[model samples]
Every structure is written in C-alpha cells, then in structure tokens.
Target: MSRLSLHRRLAFYGAAAILLALAAAAMGLTWLFGTHVERRAIAEMEVQLEQVLSGLTIAGGRLTADKLPMDPRYSRPYGGRYWQVQKGGETLRSRSLWDETLSIDGESAPSGDVRIYRQRGPGGTPVLGIERTVRLPATLRGGEAKLTVAMDASELTEARKAFALDLAPSLVLLAALLIGAQLAQQVYGLRPLKQIGRRVSDLRTGRASRMGADWPDEMRPLTNEIDALIEERAADIERARFRAGDLAHGLKTPLQALLGEANRLSEKGDEAAASAIESVADSMLTHVNRELARTRMAARQSGTQARANLAEVAGRVVAVVKRTPDGARLEWTVEAADDLVAVIDPADLAEAIGALAENAARYAEKAVRISARRAKSKLTIRVCDDGPGIPDEDLMRVLERGRRLDEGSVGEGLGLAIATDIAEAARGRLTLEPGKEGLCAVLELTAAGT
Candidate 1:
C-alpha cells in the first residue's frame, strides 16, 4: 500500500551483482592459476629431461652416461626430482629415483617428440613429468631409448594451493572495496530524489506553492510534471467551489419562497396543513445546506495546502462556543500544543472542531474536555463529555445526516455528519467511542511538518 524506497532496493541489487561477479572472478582466477602452475612444472621437467638425455650414449649395446644432472635433489633418494633412461631392456636412472622406477603408460609418440604425463612418485605422491624418445647414432647398434624427468606433482599442487590462499584474502578485500564504492555511488546517484521529496513536503505543508528549480536533468521533467498536477488540481477545486456556490444559491431562493408560502397559509387560518408544509420545507432546506457545506468543505480541503495552529483554533472555538447558554453552564478544559499545525484550512478545521465542541457542550453533565496533539503523520483532536455515553450501535448512526439520537433535542442534525465529511475530505477520519463517563469524538487529520 505504501511506496517503497528506491535507494534501499538499488543498494541490495548492486551488492548482489558485485558478489556474484566476485564469486565468478575468484573461481576463474583459481582455475587459471592451477593450470599455469602445472604447465610450468611440466616445462621445467622437459628441460631437465633434455639435459639428462644429452649425457647418455649407447656403448657396447649398453646405456652409459657422462654426467648426471648437477641438481642436489637428483642425488638424494626421494629428493622430489628424478630422471631415468631405458634402451633394449636396459635401464638407467638418476640417484634421486633410488630403488623406485618410473612407470610409463607407453603412450605412442614419434621419436624425438616429447610427451607429458602424471604418475605417482615416492610415498605415493603425485608426480608430473615429460618423456621423450631419441634415436641413437649407429655407433653401437641403432636403437631408440626413452628418457623421462619428473618432479613430485605435489609441488605444483602446493604452489596452486598457496596462490589460492594468498588470493582469497585479496579478492575478499577487493569485494569489500567494490561494495563500498557501490554504496557511495548509490548515495550520490539518489541524492536528487531526497531533495525532491523535501520540496514536495514543503508543498504539502504550505511552505512552498510549487517545486523549486536546480534539479538534475534526469529529474527535472518529473518535478515539472508534479508542479503541473498541483496547479491543475487547484484549478479544478476552484471551479467546483464556484459551481457549488451557484447551485446552492439557486436552490435556496425556491426553498425560501416555499417557506414564505407556508407562512401565508398559516396566516389564512390553515394552521395544521401550513405547519406540515413548513416542516417539509425546513427539512428540504436542511438537506440543501448540509450538502452545500459538504461540497464546500471538499473544495476547501483540496483547493490549497494550508497549516493551522491547533492550539489557536481550539482556543478560538472554545471562546465562541462557551458564550452559548448550554456551554456557559459547564466547565471547559482545553489542552493543545501551541506550535502543532495540521494540513487543513483554518476555517474548515474550525468548523469541524466547533461541531464537536458544541455537541459536548450540549450533553456534558458537569464538564467538557478538548485536547489536541500530533504524532507521526497524524494530528488528533479529541472532545469528551461527562454525560451518559452513547451505545455502540448508535455511534455510527449519530454521524449520519439528519439522524438524531434524541429527537426531542432542539438542533439541526448536521453537526457530526459535517465534521465527519470534513475529516474525510482532509484524508482522515472521525471515530466516536465510549469515554470514561460519556461519548468521545476523535477527529484525526494529517499533521503539517515544518
């Protein structure tokens, strides 16, 4: 039922997008890093394999070597780097292999070509290596031999693990930074909207008649449209008021002529029929006036945004109503905040409160209490009496036009009904409930904010 805030929604979506992107980036970076580390290990092993092969030659149909790789790891058993050569079922291996043998799957590769693969090493650790076949010069017997250089694959795996460990914190930090930046962007991008809201509030409180300038290009059109709508609404209300006045005047002339005719009949010795005619004419007049008042209240409520001090209006109503015979006999207590203002026309509010105060004055046994205060978006004015309270079912009926709970009481029946219409026109309501000793009438209206 309420308009949701745009800033909060945008922030949520922006953060979600950043989080998903960071997640994808994290996964992609990890994949590329692992692939690179594995390839680098294989390339290094291939170079070592070439070095090991350079030192090998066939002599008397037996494999021989001039020198082995100088790396200290090769001389140490299970030192994590190894090389091996094989020819005609004869085998040669670096000292690093110790008693372990390199197991090749015999994947077919042309001579002088290199193949890369992985295998388990000492302690069942994973190993990455490159293997190649070379053609020996026919110096002894022309033959092909296989040479392989391998280092523990765990090294590359550990490097990738370490890289991920290091990158995780950085990516998390980057996500935080990006999210923070997104928050700032949201604030900056939406600041204009905040300004527009304040200006619109000013319009509602009667501080400004129209939206101000200096808006961003993106929002300027909206502000212009809102200003136009306010102006249009005002014009419509003005014309409505004018039409209502003309119609009420036109109807009042005929009703007054009818009442005059009844008086003439009464003067001519037809007392009973003339009295009935007068009563009917009076009832018709009440209806016309009630409808007219309601229409005028509506036009006034919508025609302008005006703030009225509740304390001042209450004081004025009390001053005028207490002069009556019924109100003068009873004590009156009024409580109102001096600075509290409501978004309603002063005359309209006065008329509404006057109705409640007059009603309380008529029924209160000993005293009447009137209080006004504002909370959040609403301003409440409550009038209570010390007389007998009305029944629950009669509460709503009493506010209907021309419906009186006590027919013997001397009064027009439009007080509560008109007050109810006035409250509704101002986008509020009137609730009649049982008070401690009597009926309480509460008129709630939209409060004005400075």
Candidate 2:
C-alpha cells in the first residue's frame, strides 16, 4: 500500500470528523425547528378553541353556534381551520367542514379538560386539533359536550423542508472553507522539519558547521543538541589527531636508538647480529607508522566531510611516486576527471591513494597506471601495475598487516592494510584484484554532491 503524507492524512481524518459533526448538527437543528413550529401551531389552535367556546349558546336542550369564530379561514369552505361540537349522537360543524368531518371522537374529554392531537380533516389535509369538554347551562340540558378546533399540519411540514433546503448550501460552503483553512495550517506547521533537513545537509557538505538558532521553542532543544554534538565531535577529532602525531614522534626516537645500536654491532664486524637487529627495528617502525596513519584517518572520518578533488589528490601521489628509484625505470600514467569529487578530507585521501600508487610503482616491471572516476554516489580510484601480481590465493592475505607474499620484500607488508583501514573508517572499501597485466588496487568512496 502506498503511504499518505502527513498533510493528506490529517486533512482526510479532520474533514471526516467535521462532516460527521455537521451532519448530526443539521439533523438536530431540523428536528428543533419542526418541533418549534408544531408548538406554535398548537398555541394558535388554543386561541381558536377559546373563540369557538365563547361564541356557543344553549337553547331548548340543544346546542347552537349563534356566532362563529372570527378566523376568516373557518368561514370559508374547505378552510384549513375548522371546529366541531358533539353531544350524544348529534353534531355541529364549521362551514369550512363542507361535508367532511374532524376525527375528535371515541376519546374522553372530562369536564373542563382539553386535549390536543393530530388527525386528518376536510379534504384529507393533515391537521392539529384541540378538544375540550364543556357543561351546558343549568337553564337548559344537564350534560357535557365536546368542542374541537383544528388547523392544517401540512403547512408546518412544508416549512420544515424549505428550511433544510436553504440551510444545505450554507453548510456546504462552510465545510469547504474550514477544510481549506485546515490544510494550510498543516503545511505551515510542518515547514520547520523541512528547514532542519536542509540545514543538516549543509552541515554534511561542509557548507555549514553548526545548526543556528532562532528556531521555534519546540525545535530549539533539538537544534541546540545537534549543534553541541557537532562541536563535541570536532573537538574529539582534533584531540585524536594530536595524540596520534605525538605517539608517532615519541616512538621515532626509540626506534632510531635501536638502529644506532645495530650500527655499532656492524662496526664491530658482527654483520649477522647487526642485520637481525636492524631488520627487527625497521619492521617495528613500519608497523608503528601504519598504525599511526590509521589512527589519524579514523579521527578525520568522525568530523565533517570536505569535498576533495579525486584527480588532484591522485595526481599529487603519482608525481611523488615517479621520483622514486623503482618508478624511475617504469612508464607511469595517471588519469582522472578534473571535476571528480568525493566526500573525504584531501590529506586523508592523498595518504591512502598514495600508499597504493607507491606499492604499484615499487613492484612494476615496465609500467604503472592510476585512474579515478565519480559515478553517482560512488567514487572509484584504481592503481594498476605491470608487476608479478599476487596469486588469487594470496590477494586477501596481502590486505592484512605484515603478511608479505614474498618474504624477501623490502618493507613490512602494512601498506595495503593501512589503506584498507583508512577506506573502511571513511565508510568505503579497498579491494585487490589481478588485472589483465598486473594487480589492480581498487579504492571506492562515496562521492559528494555536485
């Protein structure tokens, strides 16, 4: 399933909640309006009932409407308002009745009591009726009679429908405006997160060193923490580099002392003893240098990245290697795109690639080649030499410190190991493979942005 963005998810759920609330409110309002209209209609019927009762009279044990109600509709035929009086089986109806009758019978209306209900009337019109029982004058009959006043209920129903029709459009417009405003609020609220992302990118690319201030209070704690972390990291890297340099310099004196003692033995004509002591001292010095180089590389990797030109770093290494005794007899070729860049410190990158290029030049019989390229997020550097390449079985071993394939090799086999350590600390890798004519040493790093 595809994921919905924050704005979409909030908008969808918020809109749904609003719609539900409006629907319920619309229903409640419709019902209230209908109920109010009904109550008002009942009040109006009560007035008509009073008028009808006040106009009644009794003569010779019979009921009479000497005067009718004042409502004009009651005088007209099929009028929406009507009245009736009933005693024993005889009936008196309004002229508006027009041969149709109100159904106010079969229910008790005790003396001085009034009742209100709904019934069909003249012309099958839905109507509300109020009925009351009254006592005849003592001068005439000795019983009670029923008088009812009714008004059409269809008009009330029609009014309710019209109210809903008018209300629908206004509610629809309100819903649209509310949902639009909510979406705008979400975009405005989430903009801070976007700002954080761009700032962090700038930090990684060396364009910015810290997350600046003036952020909203909600984001201030986070931004402050990130700024502090970057500062602490920079300080830690600097301290590590200083310690590595100091350690290397401190060990140099002791190793030189060992060499000096070996020279004294050689002067005394004990050549075999001198050679053994000198070889051991030289191996220890090489190992110390390799370890120090790795320590410095690790420190650099923890700090902010700097954009380094792949071609520039490789070219400097090749130029220096060409001046060496082994490279002087070989044809050296260096190739790289001028614009190729990697997310690595320039000095660290030079040290790593320089080791590989130097090894290639030292072993090559006829030629040495160095090349570099940037492809998307990956930057690749290769050093190839026309040398007696290590056999496939020994290629992996060559990457381990002090594991020389040829015991007679001049230096401790720590060059490739140091390069591998540097590459791995930089979040990259180094691999050695046999090429068409020699061994090709591959160094791959992540490229910086354009």
Candidate 3:
C-alpha cells in the first residue's frame, strides 16, 4: 500500500485504540451477565428446596410428605426444574428427573440448611442442584432424610452467546467511522503546505516577484523573509545601474577634449606622432567602453536569480579562456562536482570567476586550477595560478576600483574591482591570498535551496 500517508496512519492508530477499548467493555459486560445468570440460577434452586422441605410432616409416629405447592410445569421431563427426597434406602423423585435419579455424592447431607452443587441432567444439560436433610419428630421415625432440587442452566449460556453476537457488528462499524473521520481531519490540517508549494511554483515561473504576506501564522515569517531578500536584490541592482551611468557621464567631457586635441595635432602634420596620440585616445575609448559594458551587464542582472552550478560554470569559463591566445598555452584544471549550486546570478558568478581566470592566464607559468566546495551554508570558489604571487601588502589594495599593480599594462585596470562589486551586490565576499604555488582568488556565496 506504499505505507499510509500521515493522515491515514494517524486514523489507523486511533481506530486501533478505540477497538481495544471496545473489547475491554465487551468483556466486562459479558462477565457481569455471567455473574447475574449464575446468581439467579442458584436463587431459583434455593426456592425449590424450601418448598420441598415445607411438604414434610410427622403423623402417627411416621414421617410423611404432604401435597407440595410446586408448579406442575416443573414436573415435566427436561422442563429445567426437578426435586427428589431420600429416606435411608427409599427414594422419591419429581417427573422432571426423567428416569434419572439424583445421586447423593456427599458423605452426609446437612440438616435444615441448603447446599448447591453442579451436576449433569439426563439430557446432558448442566444443572444447579440444592440438597438438604432434616430429622422427623419423636412421634415419627426420629431419623433424617435428604431432599434435593435442581434446575437446567443451558439457557444462560445461549443468552451470553447472543449478547456477543449483537455487540460485534456495532464495534466494527464504530471503528470504521472513527478511522474515516481521522483521515479527513489530517487532509484538512495539511492544506497549508500545499498552498505554499503552489506559491513557490509561481515565483519560479516569474509570475510573482514575492510571496505576499497573507499566510497562515506558521508560514508568515518564512514568506516575509523571502520577500525582503527580493526587495534587497532589486535595490542593489538599481544602485549599480545609477553608479555606472554617473561614472560614464562624468568621463565624457575629458574623453571629448582628448580626441579634439589629437585631431588638432594631426592637422598640423608630424603624422607619426599624431597617429600615436590617436592610438592612445582610441585605447582610452576602448577601455571606457569595456567598463561601461561591464557596468550595464552587472546592473541588468541585479534581480537575476539563478542556481549557479559550480563545476559547470567553472568548466565553461575555462573552455572560453583556453581559446584565448595566452590562455591556449596555460594548462587548466577544474576540481568540483557538477551538483554544487550557489543561489546567485549565473552571469555575475561567471564574470567574477572569469576575471580570476584572465589574471591567471596573464601571469601563470604553467597551470591555472579552480576548485569549489560547500562549507556550512556558503559555497566557496577558488581559482589558483602557478605565477608570481602578489605581495602581501598589495593583496587587499589590488581589488580597489581603477587600481592596477602593473601601471605599464593597458586595458585591464579594473577587472578585479568590477568582479568584486558584482559579488558584493549579491551578498558575497571576495578574497585574494598567496597560493601554494602562486596566487589564489576566493569567492564565497550562499548555497542554493534544493
């Protein structure tokens, strides 16, 4: 049955407990009924014993029994009532004994007081028998005689069997009803979990940006926290976009003046020097364009949510870097499983890691290595290169905006800074340290939810 669901399992347990209680109740009632039946049978036998005793009298110095007032129905064979009297060897019996004489099994019957015993009747029905002995007056024989009374108890057994038969079906029906009610209650109780699943699905398909606040008390806090994270990401993206635009606007006038001066020098001849100046201006424009592109990319991805597979991203970045002129000569290796995922924008993660790979390709003598692992709630990505390591004093300063360790190098001044900015916006951190062989850059971000 694939095991019962939580609701059905609880219902089954409840029904089992109820059935146990019902069984206990049935047993108690049956015990009480048997006790009542036994007491009634004994009482009836005592009454018959008293009637038979009353019939005894003494007359003419002889003991004799007068006409007894017992019901005639009790005299019939197998009629469930009987009586007998014995004086020495002489015996007299009621017709209800049906040719079966009552045997005196006790050593001697007690006088006046009645005693009860169980014996089998002619028809094999269990019977309750009461016996008594009494002495005659002096005028009579002055000896004792025994009298016995019995009644069939087979009817009491039949009544008990019928009672159990009547109760069995009722207990079964009650158990079934209780089990059904428990299952229904469980289904209703879990309805909120189902609603939460649907809301998450809506968020995944972009139908909703946030799971708004109208939820059950148990789920409200979780939903509110998710909404707050979405809002925070949106604000970070907006701020990055504004900064990029402002930086671009602030640099336009100076770039224009540089181009105008280069153009004026070209018009005055000395063509070779003019060409050199134009090249510098063009290089400046190219670097500005790359910076603007990086900023726009970062801004557009502000609220871009994705599960970044660490190994896949690293592998893809390495493949692209391997195609570059300098990257082609460097050995690349990735060490992480594909299932490791981080909850961050994939493009931002790639760009951050890609900047580290580019730096490695530029300085590494032989190999560039990447490794990723999950620690507690965070995922850490490390890129290492077998190149001249950064000086300890410059490690932290290297990530500052517009700073470059090699001032003679062109068109690569802000790579680390731009990557670090993207990581910061996603609530991640970046670090640079001396590797075993050379240099290592580490990026840390939150792990994705399964």
Off by over 4 Å in 1: 1-23, 57-63, 120-125, 137-143, 175-243, 260-279, 296-342, 346-411, 427-447
What's the TM-score of each model vs. the native? 0.65, 0.71, 0.44
Tell me the spans in candidate 3 whose CA falls farther than 4 Å from its real position: 1-3, 58-64, 67-69, 104-114, 133-142, 168-450
lDDT of each: 0.84, 0.83, 0.77
Candidate 3 lDDT for residue 114: 71
* Candidate 2 C-alpha lDDT tens digits along 80-137: 8889987789788998898877776467667898888787777778788888888867
Model number with the top TM-score? 2
The residue ranges of model 2 lying beyond 4 angstroms of the native Cα positions read: 1-12, 35-217, 300-302, 328-332, 390-397, 433-436
Q: Which ranking of candidates, highest TM-score first?
A: 2, 1, 3
Output the lDDT of residue 361, model 1. Answer: 89
Q: What lDDT is reached at residue 32 by model 3?
A: 86
lDDT of 1 by residue, 364-415 (tens): 9999999988888888999999998899999988988878988998667888
- Report the Cα lDDT for residue 420, model 2: 86
Alpha-carbon RMSD, candidate 1: 6.7
Backbone clash tally (model 3): 1
Highest lDDT scorer:
1
Which is better, 1 or 2, measured by TM-score? 2
TM-score for candidate 2: 0.71
